[model samples]
Target chain A: MSSPSGVLATGSAGDTRPAPVVSIRGVSKRFATTGDDVVALTDVDLAVAPGEFVCLIGPSGCGKSTLLNLVGGLLPPTAGRVEIGGRPVTGPPSEVGMMFQKPVLLEWRTVRENVLLPVEARNGRKGAKAARGRADELLGRVGLGEFEERYPNELSGGMQQRAAICRMLIGDPDVLLLDEPFGALDELTRERLNLELAKIVSGTDKAALLVTHNIIEGVFLSDRVVVMSARPGRIVDVVDVPLPRPRCLEVVTTPEFTALVARVRELLELGHDDDGKDGDR
Target chain B: MTAPADQRHEVPAPAAPPPDTRVAWGERPSIWVRIPTWISLSGFILVLFALWYLLSSLELVSPFILPDPMDVVAELGNMANAIGTGGLLAEALGITVLESILAFAAAVVLGLGFGFLVAESDFGRIVLMPLLVAVNAAPKIVFAPIFIAALGFGISSKVALGAFIAFFPLLVDTAAGLASVDRDKATLFRSLRISRRKTFFKLQLPSALPFIFAGLKTASVLAVIGVVVGEFIGGGGGLGQQTKIAGDLLATDRVYAYGIVLAVFGYLFYAVVAYAERKIVFWQTPHGVQAGG
Candidate 1:
């Protein structure tokens, strides 16, 4: 029943609300282990509206990644359903592009070729060749124009991830599923990429659901930050960021941004305490 | 951590310099380092050669035991003439080269086939893995007599022995390589809805090439050894048989001549594989040094 603030479910007066690009309803995932079945996520319901950015943030083991996977259609829900572009997701949906913490660029491939992977995967070699101009444009947008012919191993970590982002966009997917895509970068590089990412997503109709543990990053980028609790991962809070759009690195110093960060940290600690108390039973 | 606004932009820009994109053929030592290295190498060899010539010419050792360097050179000239004219030593050398090449080819085909099978399927792994381990644990040269007994004194026996010896390293390395595909890459492939065939060819196979080549390099050396050992046991035509005959006849110089030819062949075979590895797995740095950002 929880929806991001300002994103109204029912149109008041005569306003028409757009349908979400990604919809997950009562989705639960349990992983079978030797001792017992591990509940990764339980009764997870989420909707990412087109042109909105949502971040899932929690301490480790909260299964933020599991929720992303559900939307990505990489993992099937044990209960309920997930829909992308109004279609029930039974496999990796062509409408979604997923990225992990690691760039996952093919070392043998040139950066341009790596960016064209998804298109090639979907539409074959001819499709990839047709998309080369777009791939180079994406790379150039991320300051990697000169490095397109270089291999993944030849690029720096941030540059490689930039190439990976171009790869995700080359498929022209409706939704982006990012699982800690910038979690591996240094603080400065992470901030710069965050700015680039915001610019990349702002004018587009694509919805982004990013999973991150960093509180500042979530607040800086997302319209709403979905906080989950540990282990039997449940949505504990959905902190709305009312910060001004096109935020820069200076926004972190503002009282509102700092307040939002402190609130999320408090909720995370509360979740940790709750987990500790539950273990005593 | 909050940095001053101006410093924030500065750090991101300078944090990563453009990575060295050139193939790490190797870190080419500076001319300063190269000159000294060459000097030391040639100096050591010259000293050894001078000692060898002095020890022989002064009769410090009997001629039967150690021939003069000049005599060895003369013997080399004779062997070269024999090779040019298609003499016995030349035929033996040709047979040895043919056996090594054939064994290496057979080992590569079967090793790659079985390596992939074991790596890709549970049934193949469960049944063949233990058998491979057991066979690999044994000294492969010892099996030459068994191959000779079954296949007789022929080129086939030598090739069989060579392939049997060389096959293990390639198979083990290949399986390890296939299994070592990055977990994230697998997930990325799955997320992209890439076909299983494309995933194998595009992602897994290229990643496994380095390991497969490493195994091949080891197999190359083993292939030659296997063929020679088989020839030694079976008295088939090869440098191994020629050397044995020369030793029995007290033709010490001829034995030395055959030894030199065999050593050259082995080195060349190994060099050829190493060169191929460098070409095929072009991304990998020589000596496994990861080229840095």
Candidate 2:
């Protein structure tokens, strides 16, 4: 029930615009329960161009996660179509990498083995063996090179999430789907991880879509912030962040950064008020 | 705020403190303050032995009912000598050990097969669970006479009874372990689109191993007890028959000696399974180690 505002950023809008790597058009989802069918989303449209980082943010149960799941092929949209690389997504696409809120590392496997899970699933044991060098490089980039031999239970929460990020990268996927990957960490750890994530995705051709609850986080790491409304979710605003690339944590101190954060916050409040007035009708 | 800075710097004298005999959290106590487990256990055992000896010496209980501790010890020595010479005691111990091992093997195979069925399919759970519960509810000893009558007064009947008693624990624990996989981990597998076969082999089986081992430990002890009870009811070969014969002759000391030997053998069976669990499930954190953040 979001009030429509500015024109949506379709990534296919302008004549010079590149074709989007991930495209969702007029997607809706509903869940059938014993009493009623819960409408999770309604007529949501979004696209991520190559090298663009987009974040979806809203209050709880706003279906930001539902939209992410649709793109990842974990759930099918009830109405419109979701496509990756111009093909309809019927199942988990090989070119898309996903990271969830929990690290969800297999407890019995070592750090290196956990990172290679997707590789093994796709290509079996030999493929995982051939990719060990790439796994090591990714782990080293995240400061986990020395701990590759240790099991998941031995690592701290922050370290486990870093390992999960390494896992997402190991597949060499063209698009990344992240669902609040750092939502459980402490404030300081979350900030540090945000910086790390930004650095990792900067020079890459990969298109990234992140779902988060933190306003500062959505603004800090994304090129566009997709503001969503409460249940029966729809996009209310898509704020383009004009901050320069290769950004650092110090950018938050700038007046320009403060204004963008304020803008997203305002749209979120507007959506929240619309939800209260509806009152589950 | 009214007090001068110099006066505030001076601390007030406190009253005499009460003694703190309570132990501090996570602090290791001095050897003098806490007795080791083995020492306390053995000390309590020795006290019980002393009490038995005093009661017997004072003639508080008749000799026919309560033999002296020295007499029981002498009987144990005699049995040990007989075992070394490959006599009656040795034959009985060998037979009992063989029956227990065979029964344990049968129990494990049947338990794992049925456990997997119950855990994997709705039809199996709905049809088999009530039957399993009813079988487990009945006292297994009640079936010994029937087994003896059907299978004859031989090793087969004892093993049948033992396996029937031992398999329930293994089946129940295995089903529980397989069904208890973490929800988030299952989602992770689905996200990767892992095949169902690979998921069972790579994820569910490994996670269920610790529970299987726990069941094995309990079942090992039960197997031995079941075999002995079968022998007791049917007067078949084994230490149980030996104890019955000694009791009929009013040889209380011999009965006590056989009971002690059976207790030791049962403990050995349990200990072996526990040792195997530790070796196979080495990834399990030690008792006090914190696992994840």
Candidate 3:
């Protein structure tokens, strides 16, 4: 079975792996379409330790998002198991939060209502009063305190994505699985959101596993970046960022950040180099 | 492909800000675009009235066959005395309005309930969709006589016919709306591990609102038709019966009066639905008309 890349998986002296918030045990996914089965991920084993921030970086069709979906329990692993906080995830786990490529806010709902959707879904109308307060706190943190009553269409793409980030946080889940949440935003908005996400994730003890194609993005926000190979994806490398905590945008320009970003780029190339060979054969 | 003549290079976040943000809430439409539509509608109505007056005054058709527009207008005043709460025409109006509203209510409830059922499960959708389509294909009004026979020639028959006519579109739109939930949105619900009932109310029902309202609009208008048809064939009392009676007696002016009343009534019914739509669907920027609420 393919596991998290060897370097990061290995521990230094007295390495007793702290209980991970998320745990995947040889998880693989296969989509049975009209004809041949499409293997999305193969024997993929990984874990997110409590309060850790991990990023999965891969080329298109590398099954990184597929893996995220599996961990979120939206899709069952055909061959292996996914567990969150020591429980096998037969279905979506209440302990997890999810953010998607699009904001996925209910269009008819106001921003506050959209944020409170999961709360309402879990607790019924009784959950309303307390959840409203939590929604307000999260929205304010994301700079959307004043836009609570506005509908999604009224907000900009950046603003809508920010609200979505808040929605994911409102559940106060221990783990966050974000599938390229800022993929559609512009560069400037993306940078701003990346900072906001970093701050939000760090302030809470929630472990985060995000999938991104952007090299700099994966390196900047992640404590450790997992690089996976394409088509039947397997993690080939993991690079730990040595940059100091409370990373600012200016950190992107420094030597240590540049070295980590360069290392990730090199690892990605090596992963794809194997893909090119397999394709030729 | 070559770039368009007036355009710049490729973009996602275009250099210019989005129009959604740029345009202010109360910005007025250009005068040329706004005034022309109102002018054209008013002019068309005026021209139509003038043509009607000329054709009647010039004696193109016999006065007995076609009354003057002036006479039709005057008849509205005279018809008021003939139409009290107890009068035949007034009773007919009451019957029609009551039957349609009742049918509209019934269709909305039945359609929404059934639609949620069909949409929630694959088995329900597969079993019920074709049956609905088959029933919807045939002319709904053809059952007016059957309804009149089974339910009797009372307001019950008219309501049955109205509900029958309205059932198809309401069922279809409601099911579609509920089924149209985006996959990503559904994932959010799943990830939260929320109860199925809450998902239906908070996600599926709200998601289906626009489509359900569309069906309501169509059904509301069709309800009127259903009731009128019931009156026409089933020997009931409504504007349809009044229209038929006037035709037989050669009360051509009185026929004109009933026609105008029906037209005005139809518009008022439609306007009420539109107003409700405006209130409920306030989130959407209003454009092109739907059938009813």
Candidate 4:
């Protein structure tokens, strides 16, 4: 778990906060490949309190995505437990919304229809029909209301991804699990989205865990950046970002943000020197 | 010190995701590409008719063996009453159309049902699939006689034969389509905790529709073939049977006229399927030079 200091960010005098919205204890992930048991993640622990934005970063093939999957309840840990809102996660929970790297929008559905897909999938079309206003509101927030009726194929990659973001928020999930949500975008679009996501995160008390390769993005959006090591991945360090919110793209220019990025990079390199992969994950 | 120097340069973004392999799966091939091909096909057909016209006008060949194109057209015009009512050709066409429609509907329902069943169950694939493939591979024309012997020269025999013959393509194609769901999309559904039933209906089924419609386009033509052949073998007076009788009577113009009507009918069937496919998968359908989304 991260230090209680991080959780204290959400606390004030005379106000009680419950357990962290997301908790992982001794969690590990392994896949039985054809020839060998490939350990993707091993014995990693972490927690994210309500309203916090945590970013997980590491080298290629690190279990950053695996850990996100574990928290989303898409993958069961081979060893420990993943709990959300104090309950052990056995399968996908209603409160957890996930956004994959690709938009993964249904080609047949319109933007508005796609946004309400989870609601429709959980309840029937009538349930989704009732949430139409909410779906359009999300689309409007993402600057996609004009294109709500357009098919996914008709939209550009960036626009489709914006629709995907709207879909994730339409569910209004308590915990948002993002696997490189803006990783596929161009630099400017990614920076703009980081600022937008940070603003959205601040607006809602929903906790978000984002996995990304971009360290600048981590500094911009994260309250705490979880640095992980590769192979049978483990958390090498957690860097606290006391950066104030509604952080803008200008934060990347600050010495404090630059120092935090450098520090996380240093920890990642040091873990490589200390044989992170060679150790039991 | 180096970290400060490195930080002096802007932190680079990771490279953009590769453009999706458009060929992997997307809209139809463009109209710009299709138009010239259609013009060529029409030109080819026109050239063949012109050669036939030249041959007949020159008396270079026996008219009995190959009727003149003009004579066939004239014969078709003369048979307008027969084509409309009390005509053997009109009766034959009505029979063929009915049988094809029934066969097409049956094939789609059964083919999709069996295709999904086999794709979903390991046990079904292990046992039932091989048998289906064997039946599919067999010369389906051979079964026409058995159908006739069992159903005894009625339309039922033709319907049964048509249904069986058209069934295989839908079955095979539906199975192929269902199995073609993108891995990431499937994982997304699991993460959303969608019910298996919902997954099948909304995701697998819709995703499969494009491929399935492509199959349906093929099965539409096949269903026509099945019905005509069944009518030929089972002794009902469909276009197939009428054409055979016209051949026996050496009514070459009448035969060509029936052939013309049947060709138009087949084109209509194919066009209907193609049109339905366009509406259902409009996102992927090609327009001019490219299809997006």
User: Each candidate's lDDT (Cα)?
Assistant: 0.83, 0.85, 0.79, 0.80
Q: Could you tell me the TM-score of candidate 3?
A: 0.86
The regions of model 3 sitting more than 4 angstroms off are: A1-17, A273-281, B1-44, B61-66, B84-86, B121-123, B286-293
Model 2 CA lDDT for position A69: 85
Retained native contacts per candidate, as fractions? 0.44, 0.33, 0.39, 0.33
- Model 3: per-residue Cα lDDT at residue A72: 82
- Runs of candidate 2 with Cα error greater than 4 angstroms are A1-16, A274-281, B1-36, B61-66, B286-293
Model 2 C-alpha RMSD vs. true structure (Å) is 8.1
Q: Is model 2 an incorrect, acceptable, medium or high docking prediction?
A: incorrect
* Model 3 lDDT tens row, A109-176: 88999998878777766796678988998888777777788787777788888889988888788999
Task: Say which prediction, candidate 1 or candidate 3, comes out ahead on TM-score.
Answer: 1
CA RMSD per model (angstroms): 5.5, 8.1, 7.3, 7.4
> Higher-DockQ candidate among 2 and 3?
3
Model 3 chain B lDDT-worst window of ten: B2-11
Question: Which ten contiguous residues of candidate 2 chain A have the minimum total lDDT?
Answer: A1-10
List ranges where model 4 is wrong by over 4 Å. A1-18, A272-281, B1-47, B59-65, B286-293
> Can you write out model 1's per-residue Cα lDDT over B1-293, one digit (the tens) per residue?
54333321311233455555443656665666657778888888899889989999889998778877777778889889999999987898999999999999999998999999999999779998998899889987778888988999989999999999999889989999999999889989998888899999999999899999999999899999888888888888888898888888988887787788888999999999999988888888732322323
Candidate 2: Cα lDDT at B221? 91
- Clash count, predicted structure 2: 0
DockQ of 3: 0.28
Question: Candidate 2, residues A160-211: lDDT per residue as tens digits?
Answer: 8999999999998899999899999988767777777887898999999999
Report the lDDT of model 1 for residue B88. Answer: 86
Deviation from native of the Cα of residue A53 in model 2, angstroms = 1.5
